[model samples]
Target: MDTAENRLNPPSQLLLALEVRGILELQAFFAAYPLLRYAPRGDGHPVLVLPGLGASDISTRPLRTYLKAQGYAAHGWKLGPNHGPRDGVEAGIDSRLADLAGRYGRKVSLIGWSLGGVFAREAARRAPELVRQVITLGSPFANEPKASNAWRLYEILSGRKVDDWPGREAMKLPPPVPSTAIYTRTDGIVAWQGCREQYSPTTQNIEVEGSHSGLGHNPAALYAIADRLALPEDDWSPFDRSGLRSMLYPDPLRSDTDSEAALRVSLAV
Candidate 1:
């Protein structure tokens, strides 16, 4: 009973075309590497990084490396490429989560990119006691399956219909642990609105300016991730965007002006 009228549309061609900016974003990350080192340091906790659709642990290497440098035991899913929730995908994540938590004797934080974020959220939901928090990068968790440009590719890769995925409705619900959804208005793959989490005491949406493909390595996104991960396990607070951060990360909750709304409409189209 789903219809185009009811489902959010994928990003427009303009946004899709802008995905190439990911290259520049990557360069920017390297250019700012020295500066990034001063971003934030983390406790010696375990952190799991999951890749997006069709991407392997390779895509997350830079992020995992950065986390490791920040004093956390960063890990990759090690399950080949992410091809949706195929047979053993869920089990693999569960096993990894248990293994890391058991080894570290501490709850692990989950940071996922794109489809990986969906997996991370669900993993935390299934085992909140084992998860410290969840952070998603450019993940359209709140949208219908077809609302992303990669839906067809996801089907082709996973051999599963996007709409037929079980527990699809529950995907929109934020996990019990602290959750952060990082999104970009100029994202080239998924509708930016779909990347938002329902606001709650422990749920937040961070608007970063970057391409969907580069969120994993984008400097602003990277700093935000480091900032979030550096928080104490027992003390959770919404991200502070005051001072210089305000200029880099726009207020997601601010009322969009006519121009902003128009731009959003264009991207959604």
Candidate 2:
């Protein structure tokens, strides 16, 4: 059963104000960031992007475009809308992975947003050998039914219970190969704790400062993603205090508290 604390935290008025301002600031930053104009790494491993619930491929186009410019082969799930669980969904994902593997001659990296992250993790569990890494943005993996603010709305729209995770109980996550779960404490859509994966040797959780909706577009988030992907296959390391500080306080020219306060305001909203 979902506890009261497990549900989404209501946004405060201040949070709403900050989010509006943050949105503008974030957009400007993305526009100015020259690094995002090109791929961070030139190696050509395929990256599959799965959009959040109710989001289409178009929603992920900015990141996709940046990735393409950087020289990575990025693709979105060509299957129609991302409504949770319909018939043969698992098989369809498997087929997609197989096809990409055959064409690329390498395991594919998956970057999933929101519920799409859950799907990516499940796919990796099914075919570890075919997945190079898994990254999820603002995903809810630890909670049961009604834990997320969208639970009721999602059920109403899709007519399916998403909390049911058959075969998920016994399934151990594939040995972590550069897996990164990026989430924000200020997420308005899902409980922040739900975004946490139980600590494991292979899995690492990164806390970012942004709203749930802005994660995919946040400049800081994108920089982190690019940095992670750019790491050599053997160089993957758990996010340490040094790395976190560097990411959170990348610019000596700007005040870190501005971003930190913005994150707090977003959560309050």
Candidate 3:
């Protein structure tokens, strides 16, 4: 008895459907400028990026390359495409974080896209000592896991049930480390309101301009990530999207004031 209203489908938006074109723009932007020249150099900490559902490391190559150019040892989640909690995935993540931290003698920062962000948050919670910080792009980790337009497809692809994954409570719990969520109100895959973090000193959300799928390579998002990563581990501060940065990155909290009911629903779990 599944009807359109009850089925999980991507959010309907013409612009969101066209977000794939962002790749061309990204490539051109990188080619036109030595982007790394303006970026603050990192402290050579380890960074791990997880891919979205149905995407592999190849989709994250551009972001990883940019991070590497910024002086961080960025690595991809090499366990292939994310198809939910598949065999060896959780263990692989745990081992990967352990290996990177042990190898570099420093905690690793996690950057995850879409479903990958869900993985990042969980990993951070599981091993906060090994995680320096966590960032998520367009991940719908709250307000009922199945509320996302991508949920049914996720269930089909992963052969796992979203409802059975210990839903709402897990999504609402903040990771032990500093956490950031970068999402766009125009996201075509999930309800933007569901992607926000509970506002806190150690956690925040950034609203960007792009499609749900384009967040990985969105220049503004990259700048924000670099800005966050550049901070000293001991001197962590909330993202400063101030002045010029403010012009580019809108405050998600300010933008979502009209949707406080949804925010409350997200936190109820």
Candidate 4:
């Protein structure tokens, strides 16, 4: 998904304004929210969480804690703050994926935020056999990688300019396993358009009403994560938003309605 082109960048100023919700995202952790109060328990699988650019595991602690409480063996990437795929960082992640799968003797699930989402997709692409599924929170891995509001800052922190890498093209499709892209219309870091997954049998796009930063803590998002992880290993299905949950989550498959064409244009870009 990392490419040299800047053909479709989002309104940088708008992204900046939307980023302010990052503060509210932090507040969710301190609030006495009723969301996710009874999210279904998981099958006690091992889940690996990755933070966004410039953030470390500390940023993911709240999400990881929730996952743990839901009976998942959640682990944060502790190899220091995310600064992009610097020299050994990518290798380390691959090794980590391999080790986790081998040790647990089961496929691993990965959840990543922003740039970390990009990392999660690539890892699955390389080793689908070891990966059960991937869930990305506001990751811009489908289209223009340099389109993020933080691309410039990513360059500064990563010590490398934005550029294409191996398997970037393959990212246009779902990784060799079940893939879910959890995005919002108001994402301030990267264009929400670029975060949508192409309509595919094994890929899905889940829409939530929260800032990109708050996605990890958003009640709707947490419940969706629980719903996804609860799926039987061999009977995967698209998100079910038939009843009251429909009010919480927009119809992700509502492409035949008014929002269809615009949504298509956005993801197609």
Clashing pairs counted in every model: 0, 6, 0, 0
Which portions of model 3 miss their true places by more than 4 Å?
Answer: 1-10, 13-16, 28-33, 255-269
The C-alpha stretches of model 4 lying farther than 4 A from their native spots are 1-6, 29-35, 253-269
lDDT of 4 by residue, 1-269 (tens): 33446366663564457567777866765573445757778888888898998999998888888888888888887779999888988898888888888888888899999888889988898888888889999888875756677888888887776764556677667788898899887676777777888877888889987687788887778888888887777777898877988897887666524333444476479
The Cα error of candidate 4 at residue 184, in Å, is 0.4
TM-score, one value per model? 0.94, 0.80, 0.87, 0.87
Clashing pairs in 1: none
Q: Compared with the true structure, what per-residue lDDT tens digits does model 2 show for residues 1-269?
A: 44675454433444444445446635855785695554356477888888887877887777777777677788888766777766776687788888998899988888888877878888887788998888888877665555566776677646777556575544334334557888876566776556666666677777776677777777767766776677666566765437546757233223324444665575579
Where model 2 places Cα greater than 4 Å from the true spot, the runs are 1-26, 37-39, 167-176, 239-269
* Best first by lDDT, ranked: 1, 3, 4, 2
Where model 1 places Cα greater than 4 Å from the true spot, the runs are 1-6, 256-269
Worst 10 residues of 2 by lDDT: 249-258
Deviation in angstroms for 225 in model 3? 0.4
Tell me the deviation in Å of residue 233 in model 3: 0.8
Which candidate should be chosen as best, given TM-score against the real structure? 1
The local distance difference test score of each candidate is 0.91, 0.70, 0.81, 0.80
Task: Identify the leading candidate in terms of lDDT.
Answer: 1
Candidate 1, 174-267: lDDT as tens digits: 8999999999987889988889999999989999887999999999999999999999999999999999899999999887444335666866
